[model samples]
Target: MTPTLQAFVLVSGALFSIGLLAALSRRHAIFILIGIELMLAAANLNFIAFWHFAPQPHQPTGVMFAIFSIAISAAEAAIGLAMVIAVYRHYHTTNVDQLDQLKG
Candidate 1:
């Protein structure tokens, strides 16, 4: 059975909220990256859900957008993880609180 748009939206919002909280409350940089991924997943879900439920199902706009978003997310994850690895190598810890070198 196809899900309603309202249900999809609620789920997406909840996922985004959880992602935001995870991104903000975590001290580890990796956790923040995971949270960002979650947020991106939620957005992807919304795009697909809307496309599936759209009045004009013939249009593939949503699918195209979702695919594009996925590509961008993949690129983001790759670059972000690389940065995290570099930071870990230099700082020796993923904790955000301890890497405060910019403080004057």
Candidate 2:
């Protein structure tokens, strides 16, 4: 069955909520990054859903935007992971709550 915009919105909202919850509740740096990624995916889902439902004259605007966003997200993931690794090496802990001091 074909899904409606409302359905897509609901799903996206749910995904965003879960992501927000994970980001806020998790103490590990990796989990926080995963939550951020989930939020991004929700945004991408919204973009695609809108593009599919809305009329556009032979334009790939939504797809392009989603692709661009994916690229940005990839870069973000890489940078985030690198930072996590660096922090782990320096502080020997991945728990964000434990990382109180910024100065090394």
Candidate 3:
């Protein structure tokens, strides 16, 4: 059976919800980053879904947005991971709650 826009939106919403929960509840830097990435993915899915369902199928705006988002998210993820690695190297921990001071 073919899926509808509502189905895609529902799935996207679910992914966003999970991502939010992970970002808010997790103390580990890596987990939080993962949550953020999940949220980005949901957004990308939304862009594509709307684009696919749009009346003007000739336009590539939605796909373009999704692609740009992916590229930006990848760059952000790399930077975030680099920051996490630096933090770990400095503090010897990746737990957000454990990080209280900003000093080296």
TM-score of each model, in listed order? 0.91, 0.94, 0.95
Error of 3 at 1 (Å): 4.7
Give one digit per residue, the lDDT tens place, for model 2 in 5-84.
99999999999999999999999999999999999999999999998888757578888999999999999999999999
Q: Evaluate model 3: give its lDDT.
A: 0.97
What is candidate 1's lDDT per residue for 8-62, written digit by digit as tens? Answer: 8999999999999999999999899999999999999999998888786478998
TM-score of 3: 0.95
Q: Give Cα-based local distance difference scores for all models.
A: 0.92, 0.96, 0.97
RMSD to the true structure for each prediction, in A, is: 2.0, 1.2, 1.0
Query: If the candidates were sorted by their lDDT against the true structure, best first, what order would they fall in?
Result: 3, 2, 1
For candidate 1, what is the TM-score?
0.91
Question: lDDT tens string, model 3, 29-103?
Answer: 999999999999999999999999999647899999999999999999999999999999999999999999978
Residue pairs of candidate 1 with colliding backbone atoms: none
Name the lDDT value of residue 1 in candidate 2: 89
Off by over 4 Å in 3: none
